[model samples]
Target chain A: MSTSEGTTSSVKVGGLTLEVHRRGAGKPLLLLAGEEQLELDAPFVAELARTHEVIIPSAPGFGHSERPDWITSPDDIAYMYLDLIDVLELRDVVVVGFALGGWIAAELATKTDRSISKLVLVDSYGVKLGSPTDRDILDIWTSRPEKVLAAKWADPAMGKRDFSKMNDDELTIIARNIESFARFCWEPYMHNPKLKQRLHRIKAPTLLIWGEKDGVISTSYGEGFAKLIPGARFAVVPGAAHYPQIEAPEAFLSTLRGFIG
Target chain B: MDAWHFTEMPYPNLPPIDSLSTMRVSLPNKLFDPKIGADLYNRYLDEYMIADDLGLNLLCNEHHQTATCIDVAAPLTAAILARQTSKGRICILGNPIANRGDPLRIAEEMAMIDCISHGRLDVGFVRGVPYEIFAANTNPTTTVERLWEGIDLVVKAWAPCDEPFNFEGRFTQRRAINLWPRPYQTPHPGIWITGSSDLENIKRAAGRGFVFATFLQPHEKVKWMFEGYRSAYRDTGLPGGGGTAYMPLVYTAETEEEAEKGAKELTWYLNAKAEPQYRNPPGYVPVDFNVNALKGTFTGRTDAMRAKTMEFLKEEGVMVYGTPDSVAKQIKRLYDLVGGFDHLLMMQQAGWLDHARTVKSMSLFAKEVYPQIRDLPRTKPLESRAAAE
Candidate 1:
C-alpha cells in the first residue's frame, strides 16, 4: 500500500478497544510510538510501510485508545500489545518502537517467542546503566519545555511548537497524551530496575538504534542497553537527538531497513 | 462550632521573590537555612502551644520539598503537639498518604500520636497539592485511588483485629497488617478527608462517615461543596451532613483598620508563594471535566481570587478580618451560607505575620470572637429541608 492508503481503525482486544492504523500488504511490522503524539501518517512510517504491512496501535491511555484503570505500567502495555498481536494473528512480526514505545517493545520481545522475528528499539528507555543517584534520562516532566526540546532534538528548531494556534481540542489531546505518558513512566523514572536482567530473555534478533546527538539518554547508556541484550546490534543515526526517525528520516530508515531486511 | 488553629508554618525568611518561581517541587535545598528553620520550628511550636492554652484545636499539615510550608511531616508535628498541648485536640490536616511510599507507616505514626495525645487526635487525610506529586515522585493519575486505598489500609490497620490480616491493595500490600499502639479513640480517631470541589472525593468522605473539611475555597464554593457532601451523605442513608468543617484564613485586631492592615500579609501567601505551574501540574486535576466547565470552579478560581483585595476576600467569605465583633458576624454569615459546620479551621498566622501579632489575633479571637459565634446554629444538611417539609 502507498502512503495515502494507510487507514485508521479500531480492534477490541481483552475487552478494551484500541485504535490501530494499518497500511501496506506484506510482512507485518508493528510500530510502537514514543511518549509524544503518535503520528502513524509520518513520512518514516509510510516509508517503512512501502516494504511491509505497518501496524500502528496507539498504546492504551494514549490518543483515542481505551485506558483500563489497571494499565499503568510498561509491563502492562507489553502484555496488552502482545494480546493485540495474538488477536490479529500476526506471525514473524518485526516490532519497532521509539522512546517509551521502544521500552514497551523491549518488554514485549522478552515476553514473546517466535511471534516477533526481530526487534528495533529507537532511543528506548528500560534499563538502569548508572548508579541510583545518576540520571540516565533527562527529566522531561519537571524541566522547562525549551530544555526538554533541546535534549530531545539535535536541531532544537525542529521541536518548536506554536501552541498559541492550537485549538482547545488539539491542546486537550496534547494534555491527555502527557497525562497518559506520566501514568506509565512517572514512578521509578523512565527505566525499570529489573529490565536489564530481563533483556537476556528476548529471543528475537534485536537492533539498538540511538541518535548520534541524543542528549536525553546518552549514547553510552544506549551502548549499555545494547550490551544487556544477547547479540543485539547497535547503530546510531547522525544529525538527530532522541528521535532520529523524525530528525533524520533517511539516516534512520537506512539503519532500520539494513537491520530488518 | 469547634475552632481549630492551623498554619503551614511557612519559612518566613525567603530569598528574593525573583530568585524562585515557586517554593515547592524544584526549589533548591541550598536556599533552606537549617539554623533559621530550627528557630522557626521552635517559634511555630510556641504559637501552637499558646493556641492550645487558649482552648483552640491545634491543626498541623505536611508538605514535601517546599519552603512555603516548612512542616515536612504532619505526624512528627502531631507527636510534638501531642506531648506539649494538654487540652487541645491534635488535628493533623493532614498526612499526604498518596505520596507516602508506605501508607501503613502513617497508620503506625497516627496511632502513636493518638496514644501520645491521650485520645485527642483527629486524623485528616489529604491528597496533597499538585507539586507534592513531583516532590514525592508519585504518579499523579493514581493520586485519588492511592489516597482512598491508603485511608482504607490505615483504618484497617488501626481496627482491633486480634489476628494479623493481609492487605492486598493496588498501591499498598502487606502480609501482616497490624498496628502497634492502637489509637485511644475506639475503632480509630475520627477520620477526616479534606474536601474541595471534587464531587467523588466529597462522596467518598460522606460514604465513609468521615468529616468533609474544605479549606481556603470562596464562601459560595464552600456552600456548594457542603451541600454536595450532605446530599452524598443522604444518599448513603445518613442523617444531617454527617460531619462538615471549613477552614478559612482569619485575622483579628483591636480595630477594623488594624485587622485589614495585618491581613494584607496573606496577599504574599495568596499571590507570591503558590506559582500556578507548581500548584496545577498536568494530571493534578482530572482531564475528564471540560476546561470550560471548570472556568468558575472553586480550585480554578483561586488565582484570580488571590489577586483581590482584603475587602473583596472578606466579601467573598474567603477570609474574615476585622474587629472581634465584625469577624464574629462574618463567621456567622459564612456558617449560615454553608448550612452548618461542626468545626472551623482558622488560619491565624500566615505569610510573614510576626509571632507577636499572631498571638494577639489568636488571643482576641479566643476572648471575643470565639464566644460570639461558638453557639451559632450549625447548618443543617439538605436532607433537613426534605424532613422539614
Candidate 2:
C-alpha cells in the first residue's frame, strides 16, 4: 500500500470518468494521446503546461476513462473526445495526439471548432499506406508484437515471453492493448482506407513528427502525411521507431514544441 | 468554414528533472491536445529511454479502448523499454489470457521480451477488465477459466524440464510445446500478480514467494486489502506463510502543497475522463459513483450503518495525502495500521499530470522521503547487471 503521494481517482465526464492526473499550471492545453498505461505520473508535458493549462484526456475506454460502446474507430475516439473539447470550453486548444490518438486528432481536425490552436501528429496513421496496404496488421494482437511492429522498428529485436506465469491482470493488460491496437490499426492497417483522401478536409495547421527508424509505417508514409495534409510540415526523429515518443521523446517533442508553439 | 483555427501557443517546454523513484510513464488522460499524438508517444519513448540515467525502473502497461492506459497492447511494448534502459526491469503485467485464441502466444511474446531485456523482466497478469470481455467478443465466464489454464500452459512451457506440457480447458487448448532461448532468468523471469481476491491471490503468491500487487486506493485503504491477505496467511491453509505486493500511484514532492498540486489533477482528471464508459446497466456503479461511495463505499450493506461506517473510515485515515515527509508519515501510519507491506511500486508519472510535475514529485521524494525509506526491504538494490548482449 502507498500513502500520500499515491493514487488519484478518475475525473468524471458525463456519467463516466477517465483517469486524468495533472500538475503545473497555465493555458488549458488539451492533450490527446496514444499507448502505454500511465503507471507513474511522470508526464513530459509540465514544461509545456507550466505556461498553459494542459488538459490530457485518456481516449474513451482507456486508463481510468470509460470505453463508450459507440467508439470503434480512430474517428470515433476523435469525435468522442471532441465532446471533452466542448465540455471544458477550452479555447485556442493545442490538440496533439500521438500514434493512434494522432490518427484520431487528424480525423477530428477536419471537423473540430476554431478553438484548435494547432494540430500536431506524431508518427500518426489513419491514412492509406501509399500504394495498397501490404502486410496484414490485423493479426498483430494474436501474433508476435515483433511481427506486428516488425515494420515499425529498423532494429527489430523481437523477444518472446512465456505468459503462463503472469497473473490475470497483467495478462489482461496485454490482451487489451493488442485488441485495441488492432481495433485502431485494423482494415487499412494503421492508415485509414480513406483518411489519406480526407486529409484535404483538415484545417488546423499540422505538424507531423516521424521517427527516422520507424519500421511500422515507412518514412514514405510520413512523406504521405506531409504531402497530403494542407501545409503540414514533417520532421524525422533520429533513432526512433513507430513510437518515436517512447524512443526519441526529446527530438519528437522539440520538433512538435516548435511547430505547435 | 469550421470554427477551429490554428494559433501560435507557448506549449510548455519544461525540461526533465532529476530524481530516484520507480521508473514509470505518466499515462495522461488527455485524448486530444493541440499537438498531434504521435509526437507525444515519440516523446515518451525518448524520455523513458533516459530512465536508465535516472536510476529508475521504466514501466508501461496495456489498456484497450480506455484512453488512460497504453503500453504494450501486445507484449512487444517491452522492446521499447528494453532498448532504452538496459538494466532496469521491462515489465509487462499484461496479456488478458482469457480473450486470446491462444494464451501461449503471449507466453512466446513475453519470452521474447524477457530475452531481449535479458534477466531484467517482471511479469504481472490481469484477468482483463470486465468491459474487455464485451470488446473482445469473448465470454467473461470463460475468460477467467482460460486465464488459469493459460497460465498453467505458459509456466509449464517456461520450466527447464523438457517434459510434454498439456493444457486443455474451456477457453484454450495447448499440447506439448517448447520455446527456444527461454527467458534470460533461470526457470523464467520474475513473476507478479495484480488484483484478485486479496486472501486467495496473496497466499498463493506467498507460497510461490512471487510478487503481489494491487492498484487504486490510498495506502491506508489498501491496508484492508493487505489485511484480507494476512488473514489468509493466518488461516495457515498454506505451508510457507505469506506474500503480498503493493503498487500505488504516488506523487511525492518537497512540500505538501507541491505534492498535492503535483497529484491533484489525477483525482480530478480520473473523474473527468472516466465518464464515457460508466453505463453498464443500472446496477453497475457509475464511474463517479464510487467517489461518493469511496467516502461510503466500504461496509455499506445496511444503508444507515454503512453511511456511518464510511463517515468513520473517512476520518480514521482511510486515505492519505501530503508532502514527501507527510507521505512518509502517512505510509508509516498505514504500515502500522495494517500489517506492513513488502514493497511499494509507485506509478507517480500517471494520469494527466505533465511529465515534469511527475518528475518533480520524484525528485522531492528522492531527496526527502526515499532517503528515509531507502532501507525498506523492497527498496534493496540488486547488483546492476550490464545490458544483455
Candidate 3:
C-alpha cells in the first residue's frame, strides 16, 4: 500500500476530540472505519482520496480519539459523527463506512440524510436478518485467533497480526480497538435491533458492497441486508473476503465508483 | 487461623481431554449425566457435613457452563449446608453478582441463608469469571464497574432502614429497595472478595474491610496481593485486622502414597480447559494485563499451570499434601511466606476423589493439620509489627 500524504489533527465534536485525517480534494467523502482504524497508507483510502477529499475520523475510544464514558454504543458514535458532519459544514457529502463503520454510516443515514448525498456500506454490520436463535454474526471475541483470522480474510495471513513485532504504542492501540469494539457490539452482538425497521428512513442513495469470499459475515448476509433498505443496491467484489477494500482494492473501488458515479 | 473445607464437585468421567477443544462455554449439556450429578452433589454435601463434624469451616463457589464446577448456584449449596451442618461457618465464596440479573435477589437469598445458619454465614461476592461473559450474555468491559455497583446495592439493601430506599446505579436500578429477613448477623454477614489478580481491587477490598481471598494462586502472587491488602487496611485503620484468605489443594492421609493419589485427583481441577476465545474476554481485565500478555510478560494463568507436576505445585505452595506432619509444615511455611492469612480455604476434595477418600482427607486435616495452625496468629500488618518490635 502506497502512503498518501494527509494532514492529521483533532476535531472537537461535543465533548469528543476525534483524530481526523484529511487527504486529496474534490467531493467531500466522510469515511467511517471498522474494528481497526485505517491509516492514510491503506490502498483503498488512497484510491478514495484520488477523486474525493476523504475525511477519515477515528471513532471515540478507537485509535487516539478521546471517548467519553457515556458514549458506550454505536448509536452514540453515529450521533457524534452527525455533529461532526455539521461541525465541518460539508454539504452534499458522500459517506463510506467499512464493517463496524458501515453499521455506523447506515445508522447516521437512518437518523437523517441532511448533508449525506450518498451512502456506501462495505461489509456492514447493522441489521438482524435471522431468527432470535440464529447467530447473525460470527463471534470474533470468543473464537480462536486463528479461526477468526481464517474467517476474516480471503487469505488468513492478511489478517494475522504479530504482537511480538509491534511497539508499545502499537500494541496499546490494538488493545484499545478491541476494547472499544466490544464495548459497543458485545450486548447486541454487532447490530442495532431497530435498525432493520428504520432502513427505509434513509433518503441517501445507498450501496452495499460485499466480498464474495467474505467468511466473517457472508455475501448472502449482505444480500439480505440490502433487501431491507429502500432501493439499496448490492454489489460483490470477486476473490475478496470480509475486507474487500484491502484484499481487492481495484475491484472494490470499481464497484464503489460505478455506483456513486 | 480457621480452616475451610471446599470442593468444586467436578465430574471427570468425560472422554479423553485431547478429544475436546474445550471443557467449558460451548460444551453440550447432554454429556452431563444427571444420575452421576445427583450422586456427586449428595456426596459432596456429605463431605461438607463431615468437615463440619470435624470442626472445620466450609466454603463453596459457583461457576457456569463448565464441568469443572457442578455447583452452578453457590447459595443453594450454602443453604443446604446451613440447615445440615450444625457447626462450622458456611461461606459461599461466592455469588457471581456481576453476571446475575439482580443484586437484590442475591441480598435476599444470602439474608435467608444467614437466617437459616443463624449468623454463621460468610457471604462472598465475585466478578464472574471471563468465560461467564458469554454464558451470562454480559458485556465484559463493564463487569468490574458493575461488580462494585452490585456490591454497593446489596450492602445498602441489607442495612436497617424504616422505609424502602431507591437504588439508582449505572448497571442496575430499582424503585424501592429493602431486603426481607435483613441478615441474621448485624448489618450483614462478613463480606469477602476474591480475585487472584487486580491489585487495585485487592486494595479496595481491604479499604472496605472486606475479607480478601485468592484460590489456587501461586504463593508469591498471593503474597503480593496480601501485601497490598495489608497496606490498604493499615491506611484505613480498619479494626478487624487484615482479613484475608488463601485457598490451595489440601489432601492428607496416613501414607504418602495415599496422599499423593488424592493430590493427583485434585490436579484434575487445574486441567480444566476452555478455548482461547473464552480465556480472556476483551475488557474483562485491565488493558495493561492484555498488553503485558501480548508482550509475553503477563503473570496470569499460563499453559504450564495446567500441566503442573506434583513437585512443582508443592514447591510453589499451590498444593499442600502428604501426611499430617508434612502438610502442617507446608502450611506453616506458606503462612510465613504470605505474611499470615486468617482463613485457610482448603479444597480437600475434587474431581473423582471418592466420598471415602474425601472424608479421610478431611478427617486427617482437621485432626492433624488444623490443630497445629489453629493457635497461629493472624499476623499483624508489617508496619504494626515493626512498631511493636
Candidate 4:
C-alpha cells in the first residue's frame, strides 16, 4: 500500500533464500529479528516478510554466533552495518526493530540517514521502561519466580520459562547486556534525550508501534516517541506485551506496512 | 462533454471502436493479501472531473462483505464516485435495497448525486441478487415484489406526489416526506433497470422510458431485455421507440496480440471467479454466497454466449480485448446488437489489479479507442434524437 518512490523497483534487492520467509515485491525491509536470539519466528518480522524483501540478521551473540561478553550495549551491535549496507549497496531500506534490536535501530537511525531509509521501532525496551512506578522488572530478564513473572507478563503462561536452568556464565553475560543497555538509556530509560531532539534531523520517515496491553512499557512512551520524532506515528496493538513483534504480529506488521513512507 | 453519453443503458447504434471501460468487482479475498481489507476508492471530485475532462464515463456496482468487494453494501462508494466524477455522467446501478429496511436512502443518494452532477446522472435500480437477498436475511422469495416496491418509492421520492409516498409493502413503511436537493434534470437523469427480468419489467421500463441494462451475461439470456423494451415501445407507441443497455466486463489494448494476451486469462479468471459465486449461495460472508445458478441466469446461454461473441469479431468477441482495430470491430456488433449504444461505462479494476494496471488501461483507452467513438451520432441529445427518429 505504501510506495517507496521510484514506483517500480528495477533491480530486486535480497537473495532468493534466507532461513526466514519473505514475500511480496518491493523495497528491502531490514528486520533485526528479535531483542532475544533471532531464529526466524519473530512474528512481526515474518509478517513484514509477506510484502517486503525482509532482512533479518541473527545478532551475533544470541543465536548461532558465539556469546561474547565485551559487546554489552546495542550500539556496539549496530556499529558494523553502516558499511555492510554499502557493501551490499542496498538503497531505500526500511528497518523494523523490536526489543533489543529496537534499541539498535533507535541508536543507528539517529546517526545515519545515509544507507538507512525509514525506521520502525516496536514495543521496545532500550531504556529502563522509563517509568519507576511502571517499572517493568522483566526488562532485565532476571530469574523472577513464577508469581512475579506472571505479575510482570500479565499472561499467566508467560510466568514459566526455565531461567533457573541456565549456566552461571551464560547468566552473567545476559546480566551484563542488561546493565549496559540501561546505562545507554536508563537516564531517559527507553529513549535518548539527544535522540528525541535529533529525530527531526533524520531525513527518513519513522514509524513507531507499541502494544495497547503492553505490560513492559506504558503506551504513553509510544506517544512520547511519536511526538518526539517528526512525522512519526505510534499505534498501540491490542493484547500484546513489550514484545509486539511476537504477540500481536499481524496488527504490528500492518501498522508498520502503513507507516513506512 | 454534452456528446458524451450521460446514461449507460442498452443503446444499439455506436461506431466501431476498440477498448472501453467495463465495471466488474472481484470478490475481495483474492482482492487483498491480508485478512483485513483494502480500500479501492481514490478521489471523489477529482476522478469525475478528470473523466469528464478525458471523455470517460463513470461506474460502480453493488457488493457486500467479502475481502474482494468492500462496502457496496451501503453505496457510499458510489456516492463518492458521484461527488468525485461530477463532470462526467454519474452512473449508480445500486442499492440492492429490495432486501434493505427502507429504500428512501437510495432515492436520497440518487437525488443528491443528480443535483450535484447537475443532472448528469443515470439511476439504476435492481431486483436484489437472490443470494444477496438471503444474505441480508430478507426474503429472496419475494424479490420482484420488493424490487417493485423499491422502484415505486424511489420514483415517488423523485417525481413528487400530491399525496405522500404513502404505501406499505411487505418490507417497508413510508407515509411522507419528498426528498430534498431535488435533481437538476427536469424528469431526472435517465432511469435504468438492471437484472434478469421477463417482459413485465421491460414493458414497465419502456412505458416509463427507463433505460435497460444487465451485468456480466451476454445478449441471449436477456435478449428479451431488449425485445421486451422494443415490444412495449411498439405497443405503447413511444415516438422514437425504446432502447437497451449492457455493462459487461470490458477491456481493450494496443493490438490484437495484447488484447488476446490480456483476455486469454480473463475469461478463465471469469469462469474460475464465477464458480465460488455460484457455489456459495449466501455463505458466512454475504458476497461469498456465490450464487452460481442466478449468476448463470445473468449471463447468456453460456456456451452460445461464449461462442457467439467470438464470431462477431464484429462486436461478438467472447470478451472485449484486442488492438484498437479489433476492439472497434467487436464493439460495433454490441452497438448494433442492442440496436443503440447511448453509453458504455467500463469495469476495469479486477482482482489483483494494482492501481498501475488500472491507470494503464484507462490511459490506453483514452488515447486510442475513445477517439474512434467520440462522435457517437446515435448518442445525440434527446431533442435531437427525437428529430432524427
lDDT of each: 0.83, 0.56, 0.87, 0.53
Q: Write the per-residue lDDT of candidate 1 for residues B1-389, one digit (tens) a residue.
A: 88999888888687787777777777778888999899899999999999999988899998888777889988889999999889998888888988886888888888888998899999989988777887788888888889988888888888898899998878787897777878888878888888676888897788778888887788878878888777767777653235899877899999988998788886566764555445565677776543332332335555677678777788878888999999999988888877778898888887789899999999999999999888876655565546322
lDDT, candidate 2, B1-389, per-residue tens: 00000001112222221231111122233423535445556655655555445455655666554444434264655676775577556656556776665766777777778887777777766666544543455533244456667776777777776566666665566677677657778777766666643355555554554555665444554666666555544444434213555544466766667666665544422231222222121112222433333234322221222233322432343323467678677666655654566555555654456757755665665566756654554311112222100
List per-model TM-scores for chain B.
0.93, 0.72, 0.96, 0.73
Judged by lDDT, which candidate is best? 3
Top-TM-score candidate index: 3
Misplaced by over 4 Å in model 2 are A1-261, B1-35, B72-74, B196-198, B218-221, B231-242, B272-321, B378-389
Give TM-scores for every candidate, taking all chains together and pairing residue i with residue i.
0.93, 0.47, 0.97, 0.47
Every prediction: chain A TM-score: 0.95, 0.80, 0.96, 0.69
The CA lDDT at A3 in model 3 is 29
lDDT by residue for model 2 (A1-261), tens: 001232344666665666654444665665666654321233356456556666666666555456654455677766666766776777878877777778888888877647787888877767765345354223233333345555555555522344555544444444454345544454444666777777887787888888786665666777877898888888888887776665566776678778866
* DockQ of candidate 4 compared with the true complex: 0.01
Q: What is the alpha-carbon RMSD of candidate 2 to the true structure? A: 23.2
On lDDT, the stronger of 2 and 3 is 3
iRMS of each prediction in angstroms?
3.8, 14.5, 1.1, 29.2
Docking level of model 1: acceptable
Model 1 lDDT on a 0 to 1 scale: 0.83
Per-residue lDDT tens digits for candidate 3, residues B95-114, read 88889969999999999999
In the range B1-389, model 4's lDDT, one tens digit per residue, is 12221112111111211221112222323433332332334322233345566767766555543323444533465466666564566666656766665778877877787776667677777765533533455433345667787887777677755655566665578777667756677756677777554567777777777776665555454454665566666566563323566654455666666555455433432422222222222211122111222233223233334444443522432356666666556566666565555556455444443445445555676777777765654432223224323
